[model samples]
Target: MKRRHFAEGAVVAALAQAVAVPAHAQTRPGGAGWVTSWAASVHGPYPVGNPSAQPEQRFLFPSPPDGARDQTLRLVLRPSVWGRRARLRFSNAFGTAPLVLDGVHAGLQLGSATLVAGTNRPVSFAGTGSVTIPPGGQAWSDPVELPFAAEPASPLLAGRKLAVSFHVAGTSGPMTWHAKALQTSYGTAPGAGARGAEEGEDAFPFSTASWFFLDALDMEAPAGTPVVLCLGDSITDGTASTMNGDDRWPDVLARRLNAAVPNRVAVVNAGIGGNQVVGPAEYGPGKPFPGGPSALARLERDVISLSGVTTVVWLEGTNDFSRNGNASLEAVRDGMVEGVKRIRAGVPGVRVVGATVTSALGSSSAAHGHQGQDENRKALNTFIRDGGLFDAVVDFDRATLDPGSGGLRPEMIPESTTGGPGDKLHPNRAGYLAMGSSIDPAAVLPVRR
Candidate 1:
């Protein structure tokens, strides 16, 4: 496939060449401190919350079985950037009462429910191995040094995975989770007690594709490593991407950046399938949908609060024009404008780039394929492209749409997961690759540290 990062814009060409420069010479944002390498935007407690077009059985956990009481959860995540010292963030953002957790551990993931021997490390909060997170609150574990010899600049650690294990002390009233991980993470049966210290799979027999409790991960990196946050809906969340495949647009962009410049930047996804830019005015433990909160309500937590975020790419708004959303085009545009304003106000120097929504004119899904919705999507895209509200624009519509039909390109219509004709609303792996490759890396990495 053609590469987007190899293009020859003067600014980008200069920045691309600078990727190999010494880390000390670059302008690191956090002053050689910790920055988020991976993150999942938490929606609400599992079982009772929204999952946005995902199959129902995937989330049928802590139920039909013993329940989530006293169980250990070992989540596996791929860090975009590596560090010698690592810390994790756990959320009780939608919980009803105090959520007590203990027996936190981190290590390199070897395989299913297994960690590399002698590499496991304990994670603590406030000098204790356990802590109680109050309702609607979140906690960050104290830094735990990774035992691996790979430093931040080590090529050996590139594409490596981390297994983070923790036990819920008692009955978690409601669990906070990111429903569609697209990656399998291990979990233990209810009443399994604290087994985060165990390296074998004996403690964790149950399997899930979703991540619970824990949210974001941060690691120390060289100063100035650009952290790019991709914010949007299902397309950005890799809806039709391969199961267990990190083929999301952001993932593709990350690999492209890594190939050109090993560790100059890290890309994290903040998209939620079925997410809308506006509407669903009230969201929380109450009134939860498969689509979490509106983009406006979540911008502060999902985009602004992330560490070392230098750029944001937003590709959303289809959900707003859907039958369920019913939001006017004007409302959606206003929301996008407000979101950009808020990001600029909150982050100061961060750049927000608008991404045109891809075509869904012929989608077979219940919520899409209407001409009215198509018109609204086109209107929104026009605003995203012509409206001077953003620092720059990525014309995804032009990249993915068929000019003749005003629908998704035929090659982009097959689902990567089930291997059938896709709904046309969400793009397949090939489509994502095209979309990811379409992004001008120069526009994203303007600084090119």
Candidate 2:
């Protein structure tokens, strides 16, 4: 919204001069060009797991006949960049017991739960086809060659989707998952064992909006390739966007970058719906929040430790101002400062960009739209913009706000997920397109050494 008082003059003036840079101009640290092409921030388990912005009925998975044993998960993921080889990472971070996985496969996705004919290839861990991850832990599979991308930056790889299929070996007590996938991932009936290698959707009939176990996907790319990590809440997580639409702001940014810089940069999203920049001090398998952990809590796992993370675009903090959060603007700013410090410490020379929080003054949600919440949000945005806390800033507030209403733009109100009137909190696909396009690619590019 055009609040002359709220929009810090410095931020407005700075955003006017932001520009886009050539991908080749940015330098990549670490000789290994292993950038994360895809990622889903692990929240908790499914079926009454973490609270999510998505409709509850969408995650209504059929009861496991044998309690999560011998089942297969056919996950569909769209990588932001192309590569000839890829590695898979699975999480048991919330499981009460160990998670055993076997019969892992990755191939070009043809459609729902189906892979392109004869394209499925086996995946392994430490040279073995199976891997066991202990409770509260994670595992990364060995790299498997992608048969299609024989040449780097192939035109065939554009807008390509991958179907990663894997089977759970035994009982998994509370699966670890990214609760709001917003994409349809398939699963097999309980006791339906090891169907990952089959490449057929017949064995899988159940549908879930959450991604189980599988989280990060890293691709081998050319040296100096930049991986732009988008870290934030539902806006960054693609809420209100169509199911499997791949139209989240980060996704839009990724598509633009892929078209503009081709093989030079990868955009990975680590946004959790309902996420906050701070507060909710307690979190884990037992104590869960739909938003997962606070931004400060997840900075290490979601941003710092990620592979090839040369730059981070943080777009969060709306939740921190929610009544439930009741976080002070100073607290939120401190959290952002700490998060930036941690990211810099963990990944030296990484670029951290801050995004202005969009207006939620007229949100339907009760937790928001209270007196002073807007002030806190604006103050935080001002700190983000003019406090010298970030390498650069993206004015998302200006991009999505309605000057008169102090809410989402009129055209961005309809929910893109179900094609209905929206709650006016989360922006629709069209709004995301605007926010994505608003981001100056140059602002997110790694700083010159």
Candidate 3:
């Protein structure tokens, strides 16, 4: 009827190891679990242009599936929730207005691809289901009582399957998603995600650079090191990569961390599509995109507010160099300065890595094209590398800039973007791979004792 998570099999492999250990302060060598891994999960508001078949797009979404449509998409996942606390992430990263939630629920499922009966038990934000996410903001549901939670004594989720589904009702259509999901996400009931409803939920875990908002999904870890959050815009968000390929820069970083290092690090991406450094979306006349959010305004909420975050890789601002997105190098510089300062103030002593806004050679963003925009890009990079506003500088431009045209290489641009939505801007899977490899591996992993 109801189960929290998978308790045996591959997921439970560790249960044996977990048993041999002492209860308190033994401090022995560790293997891999949530604490041993880089992050529990990764996904965000950055929407891919489209993934569903044409029919699905029209028949279901008609337009695009925005947050308001409580289109419940089901995925029969066999992943592990092997920790004490869990998180359910929701996004409004692209909403021009706040994203609202109503009648959200996640529980063990009894069916497979199709549904026979859903618990229909409500999910909540800090215990309440109705959550109103701010424009371009994301929210994570408080971990409800998962019939199947992680067990440290063994491979937490040794062998199991989980079916998680939720409801949303604020913004309708035009939803942002990375890849196609398992279940068909039917549109929300007639009037879900609406603005005014007597039921309202309190705050949950959120971050500007967080891939998706996080909530303490009632779950447990090996009871050691905290999590590390890597916050930024699209590049950090890992768009364009093959679905579930784990190719985003954050994903890449996590793999590297888990493969060898110690310390227990988690890289969470909180990037949004069409995110700007200082303003809302940039649909330069005649171009696509509807709106965007200013990176400066969101840094504190997204980057510093995450749970157990020890570091943040601030990599964003490409959208700011619009026809007029940012006034000048001065504007970009001020934003950077303020954003960094605000984060430092909020987190005190947390290491901030300044990732140079990567170069956008053939960018299709309407804001690009003008020599003025290029000027702003170069100008902002100057500050990122020269201003010394961060503990260390991660140069994304240095890693991916093409030797030929001085923009992203052909390998980097996605087929769809090149298919023409806007060539020159985003990268495809290969490109995301290069972007992922570009980062210095040492900077992110845990320190060896």
Counting clashing residue pairs in each candidate, in order, gives: 6, 1, 61
What is the TM-score (0 to 1) of candidate 2? 0.90
Give me candidate 3's TM-score against the actual structure: 0.64
lDDT of 1 by residue, 219-269 (tens): 877666677889988899888988777898899888877766666578999
Candidate 2, residue 386: lDDT: 98
Tell how far residue 347 is off in model 3, in angstroms. Answer: 1.7
RMSD (Å) of each candidate, 1 decimal: 3.4, 5.1, 10.6
Query: After superposing candidate 3, which stretches have Cα over 4 Å from the reference?
Result: 1-82, 87-104, 107-142, 145-163, 167-219, 222-226, 261-263, 281-291, 414-422, 445-449
Candidate 1's displacement at residue 76, Å, is: 0.9
**Candidate 1 Cα outliers beyond 4 Å, as residue runs:** 1-5, 8-31, 48-60, 64-67, 446-449
lDDT of 2 at 102: 93
lDDT of 3: 0.48
**Model 1 steric clash pairs:** 28-223, 28-224, 45-175, 50-289, 50-290, 51-290
Q: Assess the local accuracy of residue 361 in candidate 3 as a C-alpha lDDT between 0 and 100.
A: 60
Q: For candidate 3, lDDT tens digit of each residue in 92-119?
A: 5544555556655554444333332432
Instruction: Provide TM-scores for the models.
Output: 0.92, 0.90, 0.64
Clashes of 1: 6
